[model samples]
Target: MTSEAKTVQEYIDSLPDDRKLFVQKLRDVIIENLPKGFQEGMGYGMMGYSVPHSIYPKGYHCKPTDPLPFMGLASQKNSINFYHMGIYANKDLHDWFVSEYPKHSSRKLDMGKSCIRFKKFEEIPFDLIGELVTKVSVENWIETYESAFNKK
Candidate 1:
């Protein structure tokens, strides 16, 4: 659900025992694979990994005051969310994930444009998730974002 917590630790602590463990594991994977220049924080009421202002001073295109979002992990009302902005912006990556996920995961893939929803920890495709996180580097993300922004 929407977290009222102001910090990432606070958000983690707010989860139930089972959910806490699940999120923590997911968080660990994200952190381990995350590229340099991305920092962890709270964004949109979720635990977010973003391109900090020091790296991308323009901040998020939609909200100049906020950091540019890369990924986000949230314990939502119905499921845990893995939000991947990289996949959302790249058609090939998105298509690959959709095709490969089923082969790797036991649970049915439940996803949106950028959100992969896990109803249970067992539904998470940890290895695939790790690979996805590493697929786009910080420099690559900035280039992609700038290209899209220039097109607008």
Candidate 2:
């Protein structure tokens, strides 16, 4: 019932049934671990969740809306992208994560300034990824995201 949904339900509804089931599980995991005050919405042609505008409004550099720094599951033509903007911005963090990937972990990352791409539900480590997404505070994320965004 987030205004962001605005009957985004129909969009979710429009998905193929198996995808719906897959997305619902992913959605539940993200929601369960998403940071406080973050909001859910669509982005990059996929379901995205991000920190609210109250915390990050437009025009940091005179842009229309502040780019949301988010971590969420995305469906892409070739793969599912589990974006982790925070990691891509922090080399140490990313290195530590990649180094510490658990024994059973089955995924590899196509990193972005803040994204980690994957192909399927079975490949993700929900607990670790969620912790990564929610671990940093909004203020911290903005600082990191700002530094990274500014560099771009």
Candidate 3:
């Protein structure tokens, strides 16, 4: 593994200058359309927007938390990953997404886990992504993630 970057900003800042554009743009879109209370963090390795351990230390697994489920976004080495279903074990909405937006060029979104991996700028439909991010409420996302958190 890499020597994890110090801050989320540092992670993004470290990317190649040319690579910065896609991540930054996607990051901006996510921030604008993200549900309330979610925060941006450096998870795994990318610039992930999460619900913060301070808010949900128990995670989506084990016991339930008072707050609803949340999501995250990260810019990875080869692709930008959108994590709406962290360890959720499943995703019903993924089916809806795949069937609806089935025209990807590189076509590499691993939908069984709700992770949309887009390689380049033109591959993703930002408007649809924005709509998807906006479609689910915080409560629904939490419930959905928690509901399937341990099943798989």
**Best to worst by TM-score, what's the order?**
1, 2, 3
Q: After superposition, how far is residue 50 of candidate 2 from its true place, in Å?
A: 2.2
For candidate 1, the per-residue lDDT at 5 reads 91
**TM-score against native, each model:** 0.96, 0.75, 0.72
lDDT for each residue of candidate 3 in 38-132, tens digit (9 for 90 to 100): 77666555556656556567654443342233555565567666766633433456666666575533465554365676776567677667766
Quick one: ranking by lDDT, best first? 1, 2, 3
TM-score of 2: 0.75
* Model 1: per-residue Cα lDDT over 6-109, one tens digit each: 99999999998878988999999999999888999999999999999999999998999999998999998878899998888999999999999988888888
The TM-score that candidate 3 achieves is: 0.72
Tens-digit lDDT track for model 2 on 38-150? 77776545676666778777523445474574665655565556777667677888877777666437555556666666666576676776666666667777788778767
Candidate 3 or 2, higher TM-score: 2
Estimate every model's Cα lDDT from 0 to 1: 0.91, 0.65, 0.62
| Residue 48 alpha-carbon offset, candidate 3, angstroms | 1.4
Clashes by residue pair, model 3 = 69-142
Better lDDT candidate (1, 2): 1
